[model samples]
Target: MKLLRVGPAGHERPALLDADGVARDIGGLLGGAEGAGGARDIDGSLLADPDALARIAAADPAGLPALDAGLRIGPPLARIGKIVCIGLNYHDHAIETGAQPPAEPVVFMKAPDTVVGPYDTVLVPRGSTKTDWEVELAVVIGRELRYAASRQEAMAAVAGYAVAHDVSEREFQTERGGQWDKGKNCETFNPLGPWLVTADEVPDPQALSLKLWVNGRLRQDGTTGDQIFPVAEVVRYLSHFMTLYPGDVINTGTPAGVALGQPEPRPYLRAGDVVELTIDGLGRQRQELKPA
Candidate 1:
């Protein structure tokens, strides 16, 4: 199932693109006829109800209203509480960034405000010249995980997955920086969606491939197969110290080929540059750069 949202910002409606290539508006099932009482958005609270998703899947998609392709498609999930990130999870990425593969996952957080529709224009922060792009596989938490007992438990807690662009500014991240979050949390920094591929459809998260391009140049092309800490382990490991809630996203890090990994004279994003990314089974995303 490829879940999505369509319409204008703040007025987006829940929708799904069924296997038949039809877009069905499921907003009625979410807030109108079939049910009520949740976050009023596509957050963890909505996904927490297994029954709701089941009902949605069983409904006749053809009966549901078809979304006009001309309408804007917003982020798949709404009200994201946090954007947790794993750094250097890809072995090649670690080596390219001049770092060794860590024995454990390195975590960081990107402010939720950074979230936006995957096709939105990304703002290059003021006075920034090193804006960079990272295409990652984002895991959407489906259930509450309080110190998950094992990797199996963690995998069970995953609701779905999506393509996420972990946009960053190198100057804020590494120079005069207190933490990487400074560069990570800038508005419009995280472009997520196109569709949230339910976890059930992705039996092995580590088997997917991901790619990213700047303008027309392919900068990153790698697979989760090379991840130093695969999704299940990363989720299980993080659960020991924090509560994982529904709607929270875990960006599993990028592959090699970011501007930061290049030699001198490396190029970074500038206004008008377009970034395109895709993760197998997750869908595609494209963002146009804009100056803040």
Candidate 2:
């Protein structure tokens, strides 16, 4: 099932995308009716509730009211506890950035507040010159997982997947950085999803294709097949260090072709530039850059 949130920012309502490609209101399945006692929004709690999910899966789309096609679609999951990101986890991406593929995954973090709607405007940090784009496959965790004993155990904790734009500010990241988070945690840096495709639907996480275009020109075109640390392994590996909660997210990593990997005067994002990205089966995202 493809789950999503629809409405204005900060007031999105839980919804499900039916087979007809229409967003159907599932607010009643969440808690009670639309507001009397509905779940505040789609979050870990709903992801963790198998019965609730089953109910939604069985819901009749014909009966549920269809949301306005013009309504804003927000990040699929709300109240995300944390965003654990893997850096240079793709072989080609590592080489492009002039770094050797590490034996272990390179981990980083992006604050939850950085997340915005899939089609929302992305801010180019003021005084920034090297803002870049990375299209990454995002994994949404469904259950608590700590010290996962095996890859199977880790995979079981996954609820769904989504397209994530790991927007970056290179100057603040490498040249004057204490850590990558400084460049990663800028507001509106993470435009997450148009929909969350359930894990059961994505039979092979590593087989999906990812592509990003800037100003109508294709910039990054890659695949999860290139990930050095596959989704299951990254989840299992991170479990040893931190507990994975139902609402937490993991950005497995981005492929090669990011602006930072290009030659001199690489096409870094600037105000007025438009970026559009998509991951097979998950969904698509489009954002226009603007000065902060």
- Per-model TM-score, in order, reads 0.96, 0.97
Please, what is the whole-model Cα lDDT of each candidate in the order they appear?
0.88, 0.92
Candidate 1's C-alpha runs over 4 A off are 31-39
Q: For residues 27-53, what per-residue lDDT tens digits would candidate 2 score against the true structure?
A: 877763233235556788878888889
Candidate 2 ranges with C-alpha deviation above 4 Å: 32-38
Residue lDDT tens for model 1, 185-266: 8999999998988988999998999999999899999999999998999899989878989989999999999999998898
- Please report the candidate that would top TM-score against the real structure: 2
Q: Count the backbone clashes (under 3 Å) in each candidate.
A: 1, 0
